[model samples]
Target: MNEIPLEHVHVAPDDGVEDDPAPAVFVLHGRGADEEDLLPVAAELPDDHHVISLRAPDRLQDGYTWYELDLSAGGLESSQPDADDFRRSLDLIVGSVEAAVDAHGLDADRIGLLGFSQGAITSLSLLLEDPDRYAWVVALHGYLAESHADLDPDGIGGKPVFVGAGAGDRVIPQSRTEAAIDHLEALDADVTSGSFPGGHGIGPQELDAVVEFVASRTA
Candidate 1:
């Protein structure tokens, strides 16, 4: 993947709550979706938040992807980025968070991460890679990549996280979801996980839960 800069759009507080630095949430979209794809979802969050949706660096047909997809002789497609690429993306995202905080005078302690599918993969990586930097994580219809399972589970330190999946998501498979949730629990993370009666998409129920999660974390 060529190294193009990460692009994004942001939504500032609408509640008129003025602070030296407000809190923020980073929104990531699934594969084949652009940064703006999740703007509506971000908009549904609390008005006091600075919501930012990021575009993946790589272009794929009409959308973008965070990594190459490998489907050859595969049970399912998988991300093929090397460790360095993943780390570089992490650094880029973290840098963006820092820059957003500085530029908007946002509260660093309340920064949160949220994503659906592929975006959730990125969010999970960052949340697990350094839970201390983020206040909360909401991973929807996604799982933790095995590549990151080696991190010190103790690092989670009971951090608040929510992992929700669809009962009919064949693409992700129930096994992956179980493994991801199990891994988080084994590490003693403050995890709230469940499966909805749907497919690979989010519905109103999930949205309600998301709103609640964001409200609690940002409060």
Candidate 2:
């Protein structure tokens, strides 16, 4: 087993496994939120999969951030990510996932990613960079980063992807989410998407859809 590159909290399966390696879910929280922010959501998932929530490396006000936002071009809704920081964080997350699989005795082929906001952007970027590495993805309230717009990875065909967005989202904007869905669909990804009434946050309906999407794939 190797050392995980990021700080994280791990929850073992409710039904302990003695022989088989368990499926794993990596949870990445939004900006300014710690690993524990989405810990409670793990309880709502299937009892047999390993749940690991990772803390972003860069520290923000009272929490953490995956990357810094570059607002020089426009307002928060139109801002882009700091290219250097975004790339660095993407590499770190990939390394962390690799190390975590070995450390936790997880099923490497069944790994899933659940990320929110900036974390969601990172997850989508990761999937685009190496489509075959992950089994499935859940990106909530985030847009596709422009940095990866030119990528046309071969293995992304029919890959399961869940993208949830807030219709009233003022931070990232609903149009951004729509653009991501369009891009993924263009790549032939099995994209399942939803839009809720809130703003930059996951609602109960969205959460239910997420749980169902994950369960269907992981089961």
> Which ten-residue region of model 1 has the weakest summed lDDT?
73-82
Full-model lDDT for every candidate: 0.79, 0.91
Clashes counted in candidate 1 amount to: 3
Write the residue-wise lDDT of candidate 2 on 160-217 in tens digits: 9999999899988999999999999999999999998899888889999999999999
Q: Tens digits of per-residue lDDT for model 1 on 131-217?
A: 889989999888787678778744597898889888888767656777788988888888888788788888888888888877876
Error of 1 at 164 (Å): 0.8
Model 1 whole-model lDDT (C-alpha atoms): 0.79
C-alpha RMSD values across all candidates: 3.3, 1.1
TM-score of each candidate structure, all chains considered together: 0.90, 0.97
